[model samples]
Target chain A: MAAVPELLLDPAIKIWVLLPISIVMVLVGILRNNVTTLFLSPKRTVPNVRLLKEQQHLGLLRTYRRNHHVFISQSDFDEKFDLFKKEYEFDNLMRHYVADPEKLQKLKENPNDFNTVMSDLSSGDMMMQMLKGNLANYIPQTVIMYWVNFFYKNYIVMKLPFNLTNNFKSMLQSSMNMIDLDASYVSAISWYFVNLMGLSSIYALVLNDNEMVTQITQQTTQQQQPAPPTAGGPTVDQLFNSELEGFKITDIKSCFTTIHDRVLEKYQ
Target chain B: MPIVNPSPRQPIVIIMSSNKKYLLNQYKTSQYLNLSPPNLLQLFNSCKVFLATTNKLSPLERQSILELYFYLSILTNHDIEAKSTLQKLKESLPLTSKSEKLAVLESYYLEAIGSTNTSSSTSQEKKDAKQVSSSKKQETILKELEEYLTQVQTLIVNDENKSRAMSLTSQQAGPLSRMTTNDLRTIVKRKVALHKSFSSIDTYVNQLIDFLQVNTMDPFTWNELGQTYHKLGELTKAHSCFMEIAVLQPLNYKNWLQLADLEVELFYSGDLVAFNVLNDSILHYLRAVELCEVLVDAWIGLVVALKLIPVSEMEKSGVNSKLKPLEDLKGKYDQLLKLAAKKVNKFVELGLVTDDKKLNSVKAVLDDTK
Candidate 1:
C-alpha cells in the first residue's frame, strides 16, 4: 500500500473536466424535468367510460378515513361502517363491480377499444408507454457513457484524498491499462460516473424526493400490468371492501373512552 | 412558483410531513387560532428554528412553514410582506413539489382582495345560482363535469389543470353548474371569509351538492359545504352537511365541534328556543375535548355553551342554579379558564412573539371572571 505512487494531476483537470461534467449533469437534469413535465402534464383523456367507472374508487376515501379517523365521531364511524359493510363486505363488491369476468373474453377477442390515455386501461397505450419510458430512461445514459469513454479515454481526472486497499486497485480504476494509477486516482470516464451519482444527490435536494425519477420508474413498471397496487382504480365495491378491511386496523373508538378524564386532566 | 400549470383554477393544499405529533398539534392550534392571525403567526414563528432546521423539519415541513408564513402574512394585512413572501416561496420552495392550492388560493385571494369591484359581480352570479335548467342542459353539465374531473385526476400533485370550460360560451357554464368540486368549495369559503352576500355562494353550493350526490365519501368537501352553509346562515342545511362529514369522518373531532357550534348557533339564532340542542351542543364539545385535550377552543366552547343555558331552563330541569348546577358550572369554568391560561403560557414559554394585548385580554378574562 505504501508502495503506491501518486500521480500529480493538473489544476486544469479540475476546471475543465470535473466542473464541466457536473455542470452538464445538472443542466441535463433540469432539462429532463422540463421535458418530462411537458410530457406528463397533458389534459386527461377518458378513453373508456366503463373502465374509468371501474377505477374511480381505488383508495380515495378509504385511505383518507384510515389516516384521519381520529377526526370524526362514533356515530359517524358507525354510519360509515354500516355503509361500508352493506356495500363492500367480503366479495360482494368484487363480484358486482371490480373484477370484470367479461374482461378476459373481451381481451381474447379483437377488442376494438383504443381510447384510454393512461396505460392501465388500454393495452396499446400501455405498450407505447413501456416503449417510451424504457427508451427515455436508458438511451441517454448509454449514449453519454459511450461518448464520455470516446473523448476522455484513460486520463486520470482526480485523486482520492485517502489511501485504498490493494483489493480496490482494479474496481476503482475506470481504465484497466493504467497500472501506474493508484486506486485513489480516478479516470475521466469513471470520474463522470462518480460525479453523476454525487449530482444525483443535488437533484434529490432540489426536488424533494426526486419525484420525477420515481414517477417514471413507477409508470414504466405499471405500464405492462393494468393493475398497479397504488393507483389501480379498482371499482367502488373494491374500494368499499378495502376500506372495510382497513377499518379493522383503525381503532377509532379508542379516541373517546376516556372523555371525562381527558377533559378534566388538562386543567389539573 | 411560476411553473406552467394546466389548471390555474384549482387550489392545492399541501400538508407537511413532520413529527406526526407536532403536525397534529399544529393543525389543532391552527384551528383554535383561526380568528387570531397574530397568535397563529406567533405560534408558527415560535418553532421557527425547529421548523427551519434541516434535520428537524422535513421537506414538507419546510414547505408548510413557508405556506403558513404566506397565509398568516396575507390574513393580517401585511400585504407588502405577503407579496415578497409569495415571491420567496415561489423562488425557493416546495411550490415545485408540494400541495400548491393554498399558495394559489393565497395569491388568488390577494388579487381578489386587491380588486373587490370585479368580484362584487360574483354576488350577482351567485344570485343566479339557483335557476335550474332543462334536462338536456343538465346532461351537458354532467358530461362537462365528468370531463373536468377526469382532467383534474390526471394533473399530478404539482401539475395544474387546463380547463376548456373557461372558454365555453355562457350557455355552456350552465345556470346550476360551475367549477370543479374543490374550486367551488374554495370560492365558497373565500366568500364566507369576506362576509360577502350569500347569493353568490348558492351556485357553488348547488354545484357542491350535485358533486356530493355522486362523491358522497369526500369528508372535506362535505365540511367545506357545511362551513359555507354555516356562514350563509343556513343552519339546518349546514348541520346536515356537518353530520355527513361526521358520518364520513367519525374520527375527526372537528366535525363534532362544527356540529356543536352549528347547534349552538342555531339555538341562539332562534332566540334559544331549543334547550335540547343546547344540551346536545355541550355533549359535542365534551366529545371534542375528549378526543384532543389540548384544544383550548373546545374547552372554551364547552364553557360558553354551558353559560348560555338560561337560568329558567336550568331551574325547569329542577336543579337549583345557585346551589348545585351553577356551582358545577363555576368549577367547570374555572378549569376551562385555567386550561386556556396554560395554553397561552405554553405559547409564551415557547418564545412566541405574540400580541401582548391579546394575551393580556385572555388573562383579563381569566382574572376578571369571579
Candidate 2:
C-alpha cells in the first residue's frame, strides 16, 4: 500500500542525454534502411506469366465448379464438370510439370505425393537476399547498442508518461541495477530499443517507401508459402491438383426446379 | 439595339461542372458519355490539374492519372500529349506483367496515330484521314494491330523460354512468364475491337474461341463472343455463351435480362420448341426482376413472356400457375400487365438519367397490350 516515489531527475538530462539518444536512434534506423536498400538487389523478379495463366485458369475452374450448380441445368453442369475433371486429371496436368525427369520419376513412384515433391525446391538467390537482410538488421542494431552502453551506461534517459507494471522492469531497465527506481525511468540502451521498435510511424511520415514494405512482405510470404515451382511458391501442377480436389467435392443443385414457384410468388 | 445583360447563371454552371472532382464523379457515373466531346474536354482539363499536382500524389495515383490523361488525349486527338503520357507510363511502371499492358497501350497509341509503318508514322498523311476511304484506314490499322500482336507474341515466347529455363535450374518458379491472363484477355479484346465486317467478325470469333480454349473461365470474352453471335443471328450459340455468363455471375440482373431478351428472340424466330423456350424466358425475366425490381426492361419482358405463354401451358403442371385455373391465371396476367404499365410510367416520370424515351415507348407497348 506504499505510494510510488517520483525521482527528481536533472533537467540537463532532457537536453543532452535523452534527446541525443532518441535522435541518434532515429537517424541510425533511417540510415540502416537506406544502406539496406543500396546493398540489396533492385531487380524484383517478374512473376511467371505461364504460372499466372495456370493459376487463373484453376481459379476459373474452381468458381465454375462451385457456382454452376445454382443456375445451370444438371446435364450442362455434369458435362462441364466431366470436361474439367478430364482436362485437369493428374496425367494431363503432369505434362506441364513432368517435363523434368526427376518429377516424372517422383510421380511414377507416388501419384499423390504433391507436397513431398515440392518440399525440395529452393532458390539460391532468395536465400542470399534473406541472409543479406538479416545482416543489415543485426549489424546496425549491435552497433547502436554498443554505442549507447559504452557512453551512457547506468543513466536513466527518460521518464515515460504512462505507467507500466514491474513486469517490464527487466526490459526497460536493462543496464542499471537500481532496486528502487520506478519502472517508467527508461535506460539509454532501452531507449534505443524503444526508438528502433517504435519509429515505424516516423518512417511512414518521412519515407513513402513501398519498396521497404514489399521487401518485408516478400520475406514473410517466402517464409509462409512453400517454395514456388519457378521462384519461391508452390508449383502449377500442385495448384491445379488442389483445385481438382475442390472440383471432386462440389455438389450440384440446379435452379430450374424452383423457378416456376418463384416467378408466381413474385408476380402475386 | 438592346444591350444584353451578362447572365449570372453562365459562369456558375461552368464552374460547377468544371470542378475536378465533379467532372470525375460525372464521368464515373455516366461512363457512356466518356467519348463525347464536351465531357472529354472537361475531363481532360481536370486531368491536367491532376497532372500539375502530380508531385504531391502517391505513385499509384500518379500512374493512374497519367493513364487517364493518355486515353483522354488519344480520344481527343491530342497526339503529342498522348505519346508523352504513354512514355511516362512505360517509365514509371515496373517491367513485369504490366509490360504487356504497356504494349497494349502502345498499340492503342499506334491505332490512334493511324500509322501504317511498324514503327512510328513518318508519313505526311497523318492528318488527312478524311481524304482516304474509311475501309482503307481500318485495313491499315488492322495490319498494324497484327504486326504489334506478332511482336508481343515473340516477346512472350522469349520470356516464357527464359522463365522455363530458370524454373528448371532452380526449383522455384521464375518471375517472368510468357503471357499472363490479363495479357491474353487484352490482346484478344484488341482483336475483337478491330473488326467490323462479317468475314472479319467470323475470324475474330474463331480467335476468341481459341483464346477461350486456353482460358475457359473468362466471362468478358464469353459475353463478347455471345454479343457477336447475336449480331450474326446465330441464336443458339449466343444462347450458350450467355448461359455461361449467367452461370458465372448469377446475381447480375443485366446478365439475366440479356438471357431473357435472347430467349424471347429465339422464341420469336420459331426454330426451337416453343413451350420450353417460353418457360425459360419467363424464368429469366422473373430472375432479373427479383434481382432488381426497378428494372423497367425486366418488367416489360415479363409482360411479353406472360402474353406469349399459351393458356394450356399456363394450366400445365410444370408452369407457374399449376394449382390455379386458366381464368385466374389470365386475370393475374392482366393485373401484371397493368402493374408493368404503371411501373414504366412511374420510371418515366422519375426522369432518372436512363433512356426515359425508351421507357415511354415500353409503356405504350404495355398500355396497348393491357
Candidate that would win on DockQ: 2
DockQ of each: 0.06, 0.12
lDDT of 1 by residue, B270-333 (tens): 8434655665676678777667655555555665676566646555675542112445554654
Question: Which tens-of-lDDT digit does each residue in B18-132 have in candidate 2?
Answer: 3445534544443313234564677777777767764666676567667767777877778889889988888886565336567777877877766646355445655575678
lDDT of each: 0.52, 0.65
